[model samples]
Target chain A: MSDQMTEGYITEDGRKIGGTLMEMKNITLRFGGVKAITDISFDIKEGEIRAIIGPNGAGKSSMLNVISGFYVPQEGEVWYKGAKRPQMKPYQVAQQGIARTFQNIALFEGMSVLDNVMTGRLNHMKTNMFQQAIWKGKAEKEEVENREVVEKIIDFLEIQSIRKTPVGRLPYGLKKRVELARALAVEPHLLLLDEPMAGMNVEEKEDMSRFILDVNDEFGTTIALIEHDMGVVMDLSDRVVVMDYGKKIGDGTPDEVRNNQDVIDAYLGVSHD
Target chain B: MFYREAGDFKTTYADDNQTFPIKFDRYRYYAVLFFAFLIVPFVINDYWVNAVFMPFLIYSIAAIGLNILVGYCGQVSLGTGGFMAVGAYAVYKLMTAFPEVSIFIHILLAGGVTSLVGVAFGLPSLRIKGFYLAVATLAAQFFLVWLFNKVPWFYNYSASGQISAPERTVFGIAVTGPNTAAWATYLFCLIFVTICALIARNLTRGTTGRKWMAIRDMDIAAEIIGVDPLKSKLSAFAVSSFFIGVSGALFFSVYLGAVEVGEVFGINKSFLVLFMIIIGGLGSIFGSFAGAAFLVLLPVLLKNVLVGMLGWPTDLAAHLEFMIVGALIIIFLIAEPHGLAQLWRVAKEKLRLWPFPH
Candidate 1:
């Protein structure tokens, strides 16, 4: 069903790496004299897996944070769908079809898996607090409708077994999956993942890779992720941007970036203590 | 076997998302409603209505209100008593000003007025949090009580500095003031309690409730996920105050009939309701009712056992009641932090898996 709907966005290879969705032009972020990102520029196309890969403190997460509206660059123009995005709150960015997962796993630990996902439908829900208090007509109807959407996401992620369990009680890998489920619940046009496979084992990585690919294939969601694992980045991303010392060192297909000397040096040349 | 859901299946989302999902639980809810509406009114007398039922209903409404703010929204408020005083004074002024208006409208308008006051006081919560917000609300409580006491205009310059409910009727039956019958007052408060519970339950289960809980669990994540902290926190205060205000209106006009602002809606009243939510369960409506019933019954039981049957002094029984309430609060906080609601939940879990221990 999703494949048919996403046909216009996908190419022959079933990759929907089409039309520029977000353009970051000369983004320079600063933290009180210390630069987090300097003169970085990139464009993420619709329905593509765009990875920002780098070593520790490489400003990859900072770039993702800028895109997600958690941090606004001191000097830059963020253009989304041909319009320059204005100064807005993170939630406002989410309302504009941008959803993200944190590197540290930002699931609501106190809530059940179902509820954590239901919260992703916050911007989508239109019922006001008054209607909700009464729980009649629109509020109840909207709840059931959103619940159906949440249930579908839960099923897609194969987390039906722990639907009622609190997210805090889940294992680490499962928690990561739940975070993805939550981000997907937003039905975002651009999904940002900050190290989705940060603390996972080999099998967990494979499972997450499958889910990420399936999500892109099925929903045609444009994804932008920051990952440290070079192998996973090479296998999953259509185009990879390499950052080093708050600067963009390389940007191309995984295979093209692999042969780039600057990219290789950033990883291999840097000496460890 | 009794609690099993073998044959019961939900064909729709509404059925699955009901306030009480289990068949047994649903039936029990209906039975309780049935008893409250049909059986209790006929058998109720002055003592039971005044001493037990009325206060429980009123306090439950207040606790439900407070729970939405503190329990659901994670905004600590100690100004509940002040907000309640606003309701009482608003109702008193409205009832006196417009003698021709219905008491119901007066009470509702009072709730609206209290909502405005609640929002004003709740403004600080957007910037401050935790114990700081609590202190801000504590200030509100003291200031409101002082304003009502010192401001003679609030009491119509009666010189006694006390406000008394004038005789009022709903459908030709007196529900407030001296001429009101026990059953009339009981049914009046019961109607409000039922409606309040239904609304509170609905709000807490739906989208608004999710936003509140999201704010409660983690405000930062809630903001990232699209919950506006300002709107969420303030709305919690407004809705919570509305309920508390109505209870205050009932507490003064319907329940007490004559009230001194300082003595009736004091800091102690705030603590009392807070204790009710803590003992009953922080975030559950049923817990609110349970806590109210427990506290209300405690005093009466103490009086019955120590003063009535045992022929002990009334003051001694009152002192013992205080000690018992204090001790129970400590025990509940230590043993079962979630209070009676958690206890009830564990019981249901055990019942569901009866005869089959894992």
Candidate 2:
């Protein structure tokens, strides 16, 4: 498919990583008098691993929040495909094939791992409440089909042993994996991960990096992730967008951002130390 | 050994996801259904029907309804009484206006009418949550009971402000009002209970149930995953109220035969249903029935033993019943917060690992 050209789409290394999927044009977000994101401009290419790396309070999360429609920028036009995106609720954005994982591992604690993943399939379900109540034709069929998809994701993440375990009882690393499985269950065109490897061990980080790469390679899902690990940022991502004090300091390939002097200074000149 | 699944294999998703996944559990459920539908009606008499069976069946339906909202949807509602009042009044109006219509259809319409009221009150849940939403629903409870008491139209301008169910029969057997046979009424209510339980079980095991549980578990996460909080919460309210309404209609027309709004569908009724789910287990259909049965039988059993057998005062037995219920609720909350369902699950797990200690 990469060798077979399709109009405006781009190809790289035998993989299709094409045209702009989501474009944030001069996004400026403010909370009262405090500006969270200031004049941040970036575009996420289709089927590429895009990383937003920054220090604490660098507003990297705020940038992800803006892209997810959680916090609509006070001034900026968000473009999806070629058209300008509208001001809508977070769920409305999800309906437009956008899905995200939370930095805090916001999997439903009381529900079983399987049930939590099933929640991601809510958008694709066409069954009405009455039909579901009666366990009628469409409802039963959809549930079984969705269960297959969810099971495959569970298998993919190698959390099959904890399929029926309540997420509250899971360890931190497994919980993160369950969260990824849930996000993958959405089958989104674009997936957002917020510091997915935060609070994980070295072995867990390696496993998570492999999963992220596999998600991009197999599912062809456009991924926009926020992370602070430089090694992970450089290894897993196709391109990196560096933020410092709510401003875009660097945006390019991992090697390009690695050589950028501003990025070097931002990491070296830490006031806290 | 009793709960072994060594040879049982689920070949498909539907088999795995069925309401009763285990072969033993499935057979046990069928046995219970068989007893309720075929055996009990014939053997039931006035004493057994009035003292035990009827109330259990009716309250089980109501508990299932409330559990769906409070347990599965994670929306705390203190308006069960108000919603039930809507169903009772709706059925009253339907019965008086359309005498020739089947009583079953009137009960169904009563459920529909209550669903509308439920949705209207459920609007506050969209903005408010937790204790705030509970208080809002409490306001609805007071308002609805007051409406039925003050409004002459609801009771049809009766001087006593009482609405009574007139004679209604099905298949040539009287099931409502005076002269209705105890077995006839038992069978009637049993039929409704069976259907409601099946529907509730199906729902709590399906897609909408998952959505409700998701919203209950974490609304923000559910919303981020494309669950519309407004739709999920309101649909939960509607469906929960629909079953509650049907139970209320049965309570009035089939069980009690007459009702005074304040005395019957009051705030106390709301607490009773809430307590049922808490004791049964949150997020479990079987828990609803278990809690209802536990609560209903407690008083009757206390009365029979403490008052009838021991010759104790009636008030003493009644007071003791309250103390026991209160103590049991606290115990369940502290020790087994998952309620009776968790206990059952533990027992089944033990049985599965019998002849060896894990």
Candidate 3:
């Protein structure tokens, strides 16, 4: 594993996968007496689509929250880029090259689609209030530069037609796409998506799957997504971690996880004492 | 036909991101500026200046400030009067202490002082929100009013506890105090209004504006997107207070020339500014101006029609004015919560598609 970390590896499809981008070691998150996620550990590698698959109440979302710095685990540290990440505010975590979308859409409904996407570039805009107030040289140049990046993402996501429309007015699938565009605008090294296809139709799901793959292929962004769709997990992810009752039940490549007896038993409703 | 953007094309991001992207709206803005600076100053008399122009311009600044906090930033502050008092008192002290300095500098300095106080008061906003935050700001209103009224230094140890602006000048023309010409006062406030509106507009359309709106729209998402809530909320409070303070300075120095803190900068004044934004439209620069003009004109219109023409009692007209404003606010909230700015936007939308309905 250490040798592979230095040399990298080529997948079956010939895509290069880099060393560990983020590793969660013995993470235990609790809410009062209830453990939302207990003693779960996983690592997401660079340039690979990783999936966290599980049944309802499996703490998949909670694990994603911990990675995004929304929650701090009771035990163990989150190692990112081979360094232990100190517990910080979610915004601070976001500034460290991490971005995410929520289970329910979290678009700023009052603003235009363009404005919503521009917000993803907040970490990049360096102009102060005084410069922005005058808006002549530094502020104007920064705005245009950031606008170019946002526009590229918007074009890539094919949401240019509704650029000026308010986010609240858009349909759910398009809003999800805008959210993705916003997260992509961060140009993050690691993107965590929480239920990207929660309420989509068959066609919408297929489109989302394509976009996820395209994002991974084109930007080489490491993605760790929590998905319920078994087909989507098998097709999109290079490796899978399966969880049930706030515990990791299986972890391997999609084929290995599919054949793991524990994962099958968890899916088949095995009785627990 | 004139309002349409059919022939206009923006070839660059800067052009597309301009305050007024359309040629017609841009021209209209220039026209308004030309008229305000060159036209209105010439024909204005004392009655027009005192009753119409001065209050309109001063309140417009206040409205714009309040709109930044309540309208754009979505932080409901009921402490406009308190913040304004800070400006008024600060200017009063500055004017007396530095009698030789330009009144413009005093006003600007007063705004700076008020921003500090605003930020101090704004600290509570980090932990509280909605009506609870409003209550927090309400405490600021009452406490500030009390401080000004009780403290002798605030009013320069005046026998009546009233702070009055001494005669102050710009380019040898008296712009404050009793001896000033109508045009000097009008142009003085007009200058401040122009600068405030320009700054407000620029800030709201730029990165700062986006941060404020992001926090306003959804705070958790804004945080996760890397917007610092401390910076955004505090900046909103500070900037909002600065404008309110400037207006307060102008209110005492130019508009009224003398003010008692308790009666002038009280709970009622806070509500008045809040109502201006609510009526004018939240989150709109034009709405601030529109709301200010509407409120200022409402009283004059009521006096002329109810008392001047109908020979009704003055007090009755005042009562009727309150009733009309209350009813309009209710109607606006229920029917058009976006206020007059949205109405103007819808009207323009229709004008763009005129002569055909699909």
Candidate 4:
């Protein structure tokens, strides 16, 4: 069952205003009239864990996809940080310090776990091909600097033992952790985690939840995660957003959203016999 | 015990991201290149040069080109032979039209011409991939090879439907053709391969190479990462074709000294290089050279020992060569799809522990 909550983001000034770091204004997305997401207006704040929870067909993934620039909204202005963001590519979004992990484990399976994480440093690596080829000047220095940073991330994720192991051979939970570690490697301003703990076991989920909290507290990274586990969402998120059939059904703090009537109806189905 | 990365040290990123990160690997590579370029020229006689070094270097270049397409970008191209034809014919046409011009420059320029043609064929990869994409490139191979046969101009109106290498040179020293010294031809190929391999390595590690790998790994995800599939895939086609074209020119100039489309550079040549990549390693640069060398030498070694010495029938020896190569392909794919690269890796892994891998 969906949790009872309406969540909104905090303003950039650290105020409790229902303002947002990213405001998806009147977003209408369609997969040829299917209305995958319709007229959805939601804002994610500067420094909070904003969770999006809904039924399977509720288009949570679609909304996340739209935010990350994977899918262009049929009609919407996506306001991020301060000004309205024009439609941009996903790497542009990544360049803007927004990084994400997929619901399914989407890693470079053929590459080592370390190489997979190293790919996250792609945007940060500044040297060109000539520099890399000669390996004498700037490229070598940047590579070392990046490996230092990536090593810290790997250590943080406790994946040092399997650093050189190809991601294909890693267990499901470890793969999920590597995916999170990869997203974290970007040192993002906002982290979008789509079902970060979907297939993780209880112990793995608990470790992931702790890692998620540490990432939020340590880096002060604004996180917008989608979770099917209501309990984990309730325990971890500062605010929650609820959707039903692609529309934002409820938006507040955990307790206020918990008591919203529409939120109640969406989950309990209004109980019409 | 079989695979571990316990004590690999990296004092720098260059150290870590090296073509061969391990100390042992660096030594092995230098040693091999030293042999191939320096020592082998002196040790090998003229017959060995004609039958071995020439084909090996030419095929090595072609394998690296194919590796760029299939290994790095994940595009299967059966049209490598066609690109080679483009190079050979381009050289033939250029030489016929401008007889006074230096032949060496024409051979080099033919690669550029082939690159353009390759990208044109590679355009279909935008819409297709995997087996379907392979089929599309098969079209490129058959079409181009057929064109060389049908159009008499490519053969310079010769009755034999073939083209011979012009007496080409860099500085009046014979650099191509049978009369040229083996050392000159070997040196010419060595320079081009070293440069192309360097370029390929840089492209693979840097922004461009990463873009190709991103597309190769997952096109949809690569798009989300902000890579334009159009630019990335086309660049791969162009770069890959450039190398293939040059190899074609080299095959005509430095090795065969003359070629017919369906004979020297054909679908069979494509298969040979593909097998080289398979036996060497995919997506690893060193694998290209290793595969090329192994595949090229296998038949020669077979003929020398089996047919020449043992008096086995030449036809039987040829069939045996195919059987052994085919079986090796299957074994490499099944046992370690990583190919000789993995074997090299394993050997290095053992050496890292030295004296007591046990």
Candidate 5:
């Protein structure tokens, strides 16, 4: 991993301070007798790509779900921004500017690609049924505004050709891109991509990496992704958190984590002397 | 070339988002409207209009209402006939009690009444969805019918357990009652159907429709997308109920004249309307008409030709119609699950590029 020589996708306006955008303190998520994530504490900083990497059942996805408010931990406090995140409705959580793409592509299968992205803006939009019924004044204006942003997102993701195509008809890579575009459309302060490069070909993964980097660079959007690909988690991320069996085994820069004996042991699932 | 959107330019957002974006579609709609209103009157006699066309128009409204819930929102409902009864009974009672209010207002008021009741039954929707909610709606169906049957006030305490529409008219044109003309009732029904369908088109093309679609596609994802499932699902129920209720009132007041709650608003009626949606097309507005037309006209036409003209046994003819309709439903579902509306679309597409599909 490159260090200090124009490394780390940071904004031009500012420099890094060890200030946290998200702090998961003493996170413990359980299902019945099974503990999914056990007493895991992690912090994500502003304007950085952080990767949570673990084995198949290592609770990497569970951790992401907890952060996105899809799952509530049995015991933990999620500090988003400066305030404690109260137990919120999922939509409420989304409106508070945290958006996530699902592990499995969750685009509205029947809806067109453009509409799938527009679904992300459902929270930002402010219009009622009556205005929509008439469509001459505010509804029309809001629609135009929302559509412009969504179209821009479609263009940004290089999905202009599939704007009118149903998400069901698209290839896996394109669907993942559409899902990313949808999450981006929310204008989220915190963007979570769960295995964005999970099923992509090399070129598709490269395209996705570029988009992820672009999202952080251009929009100043904070990205925390769960990726299984070691190279991606190393190259794209500023810092990486390594986990094994629901516990944080290692947390630091890619080089630090890569060279850590404990991290190697966790990856190999062996005890380090 | 005639049916294509290739050269149809839309400069405004409204124009672009129109129900019929192509000029060909717009003209086709206008032509259909003209035939139903002006031309159909000249050729079809009273027996045809009263016995067949009136029922067709009335059921078409209900089908459109159901389309909003089932087709647009992807919520399955089986309580349509029951809600329609609510409209019918409510209108009947209103007509009897006041005896002075405009029939126009009563029919609409019945719709409002049905909306409230529909919302009540739509409660289980929040907790359970899909087939579960469809089953839940059956409770509303049974309960509504029970309320009308067991509670005497709905039927004006009639011993026969039925509500009848007394003399009702709009501008001296008899719309309902024993002496009411079929032409007047059909006109009244046609007007309501046109307005409701237009409003529904506007809704489905805009934000509300998207909200519903979002909920339908994936409720959990819809929530993350900032759609309030509670409000959107309920509004869908309320709005859909209002339309179903109005159609019900028309069925009772304008068409049936007198209707027994259990007999008229039973599960059979619900399935009948659902068959319309399935056969015609699920979500298409035009599918509503096609469904109503097919379901309504098929039996009548068959009865006249096969049963009456050919001197076939009445029961045999009824069985044959059942087999044909059922076979068609199966074939349509397997071949093109989209239904008659899709067929209409394909035909138009073919017409647009006749002999040059490639």
Candidate 6:
């Protein structure tokens, strides 16, 4: 792990992964008495797709929540960009350029898709309430500037047609796309996606996989995603961290994780003693 | 046909994002403003000004304020009447203390004072939400009313236990007090309503509004997306309170000329504003106006029809008015929960696609 951290590896497709962007060290998270994640340590390299894979109740979502600063691990440190991250609210973490999507689609249902995406730019918009109320020079200029960025995201996601449509009326696939657009609107350094393709059909899955790859390739964003689909995980991720029953079972390239016997047993329903 | 946006292409994001994106809507808005400013003042007598326009305009401000919290921000506040009392009392103190200063400055200061009080009450919303938050604000309502009633300073220790608007003017024209002309007061309130509506519309459309709506739709997600819940919620309270306070000041100083805090700014007042937003359409500026108009006009219309036309007793007409409002509230909630604004929106949408059904 130290060797890999010092000298980043190149993927088979020859995309150079940078040094560690985020590192979790000895993370132990518990909800009262039940341990959600126990002693999980993994590093996400910059400009690489990192996957956290586990079966149901394997604490995959919990790990994502911890990364997004929604859940503070009972023990262990979170290091970002060579500095130890402090205890902060989720919004503060987002201000530090960490953005995530929910397992359940968390789009603002009452708002238009454009508005929902614009919310991701909240950290970037700096005009005070007074300026916003008057909306003449500073507020209007800032809004238009932000709107340009949001419109780009909407265009990139091919959601321009539904820009003015309320998110509650959008289909499942479109909602997921809009969520991705929102996350992208943040211009985040590290993007965390919790089950980006959970309930998606085959075509939707393919589209989402393409979008994920495109986001990584275009933005050079460090991607940390929790996914159930083995095929998608193997194809998309440069490194995979396999968890089972609140423990890290394996951490390596997708090829190495697939070959690991513990990972195989965990997925194949090996009973715990 | 005229409501359609077919050829109305926006060249820039600014053009696209203007309050009224459609050219027809923009022109219509301008026409309304022109009529309100120029034409209405000349035609409106004291009866129309007092019975219809003043209450509608003042209540519209209150409804807009409440809608910011309840509709746009998704914070259910039952303390609007309390906040309004803060404004009324604050203005009474200001008006009496600084008699030479402009009434406009006093009203704005009153709103500022109410916003501070609102923020203080809004503190609990960070921890609680939904019905519980509503109840907490309800406490603010009762406590505020009680404080004003108990404190002598609020009513200036008048023997009558009421605060009356001292004569005040704008540019040597009396806009307040018993001697003020009907047109002067109406025009004064119309200016405020227009300004408040514009400010409310701008705030709700800009980044602040987005932050608020984000907090409203989903707090946790909003927070994760970088919207500070504390700032957003408190700002909603502050802004909402400001508008409510302004209306209260206007209601006292400009509209009614004298007010007793308990009788006027009571729990009923809070519910009235809430009903306006709910029946108007939660989260819409136009809904705020629509709801205020519906409520303010309903009683007057009822009185004229039942008492004047049918020759029914006034007391019976009043009771029937309450029954009708109650039934309408239930019907609106059940049938069109978004209220009259949504109905208007659907009509416009249909109109845009008229003469050819898909």
lDDT of 6 by residue, A149-240 (tens): 99888888899999999999999999999999999999999999999999999999999999999999998988999999999999999989
Candidate 4 residue lDDT tens string, B245-271:
998887776677788789876788778
B102-143, model 5: which lDDT tens digit per residue? 988988899999999988888888898789999999888898
Which is superior by lDDT, 2 or 4? 2
- Model 6 residue A21 CA deviation (Å) reads 0.7
User: In model 6, which regions exceed 4 Å deviation?
Assistant: A1-4, A271-273
lDDT computed for candidate 1: 0.89
Better of 2 and 6 by lDDT: 6
Positional deviation of residue B139's Cα in model 4 after best superposition, in angstroms: 2.0
Query: DockQ (C-alpha) of model 1?
Result: 0.69
lDDT of each: 0.89, 0.90, 0.92, 0.82, 0.85, 0.92
TM-score of 3: 0.98
C-alpha RMSD of candidate 3? 1.5
Would you give me the overall lDDT of model 5? 0.85
Going through the candidates in order, their DockQ values are: 0.69, 0.81, 0.89, 0.42, 0.60, 0.90
Where does model 4 sit among the CAPRI classes?
Answer: acceptable
Flag regions of model 5 displaced more than 4 Å.
A1-19, A271-273, B42-44, B351-353
What are the per-residue Cα lDDT tens digits for candidate 4 across A1-273? Answer: 122213443433353423367878899998896999889887777667889988888999999999999899999789998799998888789888888989887787777788778777877887765576566568667877888999999999999999989888999999999988888888998899999999778999999999998998778788999999988998888778889999988775566677889888888787679
- lDDT per residue (tens digit) for residues B157-263 in model 1: 99688999999999999988898898889989999999999999998888788888888888777887888889889999999999999999999999999999998
Chain A of candidate 6 compared with the true chain A, TM-score? 0.97
**TM-score comparison, 2 vs 3, better candidate:** 3
Q: Point out the higher-scoring one by DockQ: 2 or 5.
A: 2
User: Chain B vs. true chain B: TM-score for each candidate?
Assistant: 0.98, 0.98, 0.98, 0.91, 0.96, 0.98
Choose 3 or 5, whichever is better by TM-score: 3
lDDT of 6 by residue, B1-358 (tens): 6778888888899999898898888899999999999999999999999999999999999999999999999999999899989999999999999999999999999999999999999999999999999999999999999998898988889999899998999999999898999999999999999999999999999888988999999998999999989999999999999999999999999988899889999999999999999899999999999999999998899889999999998889989989987897898799998899999999989988887857
Off by over 4 Å in 2: A1-14, A270-273
